[model samples]
Target: MRFSTLKSVYQCKCPRCHQGDMFLRGKLLNPAQFSVMNKNCSNCGQSFEPEPGYYFGAMFISYGINTALFIAAWVALSVIYPDYSLKLLLALLGLTVLIFLPFIYRVSRSIWISIFVRYKDEDLPSSA
Candidate 1:
């Protein structure tokens, strides 16, 4: 069985063909185009934007991801350093979230799109 859908999400590939990259190639630290995406899948001609305001849903996904990351960080820090102050823990969490914001933004959009799109085996041959 093809796990291309799962692979696509993690790799940030096109959902239809799992070949074309979802976002444009650029330095991860380049905030200018970090979340910039191709209008269509280069391999399958699948449109990235199905409708206007489509990516608005991705904000929810991003929020959930950040929340989970925060909780995990807090729990791990508490366990590793039992005497750490709340202020310090919050500061660390803030820094961590800020540093990973761009990554999380791209990932959340990839995940959101994958939820509504599925890989088609027929698109595979044409993609190649």
Candidate 2:
């Protein structure tokens, strides 16, 4: 099922249903359903992707983005939330990474085709 909003490009689906919003409100808090994808298309009821291996690249994408976010976060925390013990800082950072990993995985996989996906029918839904 597609859970993506518009432009499947950034979606879990084609953008025509009850879903698309994973979070209750602000993005700072983790999304509610980080590991869940819609069971069926919200609109046409068609499968979101044609097959497996379809999302293989998603892992790589997620890794890259996650790494970047982690680095940025550690740097920011090191600068802003300074004064904590080294062990405590490291532990907090580790916890933070774990907390964000699943969410980032979802977003990265959801937007995996952002760079290469296309559609013959402009009217057709896309994951752009």
Candidate 3:
């Protein structure tokens, strides 16, 4: 319904309330493994995964966020960690991001979709 509400979903916390785990996988998603979300929240009974590809948009959102964060982290580390070599810092950030790449991708998509979901309010039970 609001940007703040949507961001909470992007945080990979509960989409319904932002207070619970959005993911049952301990805040991660496996593209190859395909972790499925319950159609509705266990706590609130509100729909979480609304439809197929509902999370695809979050991919674009995630890419933008991750890229920006990486760049910022690079700048911050370069300035703050004066002793560390630039190459080393880059390498470490690269490896860390790479390790969590799948999760980032999934989360970005999930959050992006969640924004629209708030506006659409398509949680009503399907008539079909």
Candidate 4:
């Protein structure tokens, strides 16, 4: 099955095969496990962590996502409450970051890996 880049990235699928999950399943139910990732793609045998410290750049991606979310939350708050206080704005931003932290962490890593791993149409037979 062929998968679009955006779909693979959003779904946190392997960039090479787009079939195997880059992260362990059931992460949504457990926030602590949300950042855990598989070492390699089960479908294509592609290494998720090509090298040590490979995901360092993903920090920037996460930063950008957080910044955008913060800006959007600020704008929404301004529209929703023109007289919003500084404390209220800070609270909203903090909550927004907390709520989206897991998602942002996963997507940032997914995007970082996708930048280097090209999709392959041919799937490697699973050993399972």
Candidate 5:
């Protein structure tokens, strides 16, 4: 079955075919392995990194995601503890960043690639 672009992105699937994984399986929480990605799409053979520095723009995406996370954390802390100290806020922000680094990194790359790679609805080759 065909998957929607948003679904494919959320699943971290190849942007073109939406079948192959963009990143290594079961590695999201593994700090060392979290950033590892498949060299190419197993189904469409699209290069995950089209060229050197291709992911430079993805860094900006990551920054935006982190900013949102920080804002959310600050708002939550404000509501949960009205008198929370600056130290507490800093600690919470640090913890939030550590907890969400992997997710943000992966999603940023997925979004970056999706911007350039359009989905294709066509029969896969005999060999994937």
Candidate 6:
């Protein structure tokens, strides 16, 4: 599949058709509704949930994303401030994770879906 498909994932659009929105409009910072996804793609009629427990695998993706983010932060901080204390590094990592939790959750779901679904040329409008 084309790497361009990742644009859809990053935008939280439908995996099959990049035009549709994957998530509903709401306060994203609100954890209670941070993951409110559309039942189906408004543009392509693709179901968001392929099956029961379909999103269970997304947890693993989320974990991987968090791990990567933590590692990157640690590496960057260590390089930039060689004498920074471990306590400060851990505090910054905690804050970063907390602030980005909603984003990571949504992106992980988008990535998990994109992994199983491929964009079809026919699904795109003729304008492309």
Q: Of the candidates shown, which would achieve the greatest TM-score relative to the real structure?
A: 5
User: Compared with the true structure, what per-residue lDDT tens digits does model 6 show for residues 1-128?
Assistant: 67668788888889987778888866578878888988999989999998999999999999999999999999999999989998999998999899999889899999999989888767546756
Cα lDDT, all candidates: 0.86, 0.56, 0.64, 0.89, 0.91, 0.88
Stretches of candidate 2 off by over 4 Å are 1-33, 81-86, 119-128
lDDT of 2 by residue, 1-128 (tens): 23233345443433334233322224334455456555455445534455866668888888788678778877887798777677876786688778877666656755664334433233344743
Candidate 1, overall lDDT?
A: 0.86
CA RMSD (A), model 4: 3.5
Q: After superposition, how far is residue 42 of candidate 3 from its true place, in Å?
A: 1.5
Error of 2 at 95 (Å): 2.0
Best by lDDT: 5
Per-residue CA lDDT of model 4 for 1-128, tens digit only, reads 23498899998999987899999987854777998899988877889998999999999999999999999999999999999999999999999988898889999999999999888776545732
Instruction: State each candidate's clash count.
Output: 0, 12, 3, 0, 0, 0
Off by over 4 Å in 4: 1-3, 123-128
What lDDT is obtained when candidate 4 is compared to the true structure?
0.89
Residue 85, candidate 2: how far off, in angstroms?
A: 4.7
List model 1 lDDT by residue over 6-94, tens digit each: 77887788987788988986655788888788899998898999999999999999999999999999999989998999799989899
54-101: candidate 5 lDDT, tens digit per residue? 999999999998999999999999999999999999999999999999
Runs of candidate 1 with Cα error greater than 4 angstroms are 124-128
Q: Write the per-residue lDDT of candidate 3 for residues 9-90, one digit (tens) a residue.
A: 6565556555545555653545554345556656556566677767766667877878877887788877988688868887
User: Clashing pairs in model 4?
Assistant: none
Clash count (model 4, backbone only):
0
lDDT (Cα, 0-100) at 75 in candidate 5: 97
Task: Between candidates 4 and 5, name the one with more favorable TM-score.
Answer: 5
Error of 4 at 15 (Å): 0.3
Error of 3 at 75 (Å): 0.7
Which TM-score value belongs to model 2? Answer: 0.58
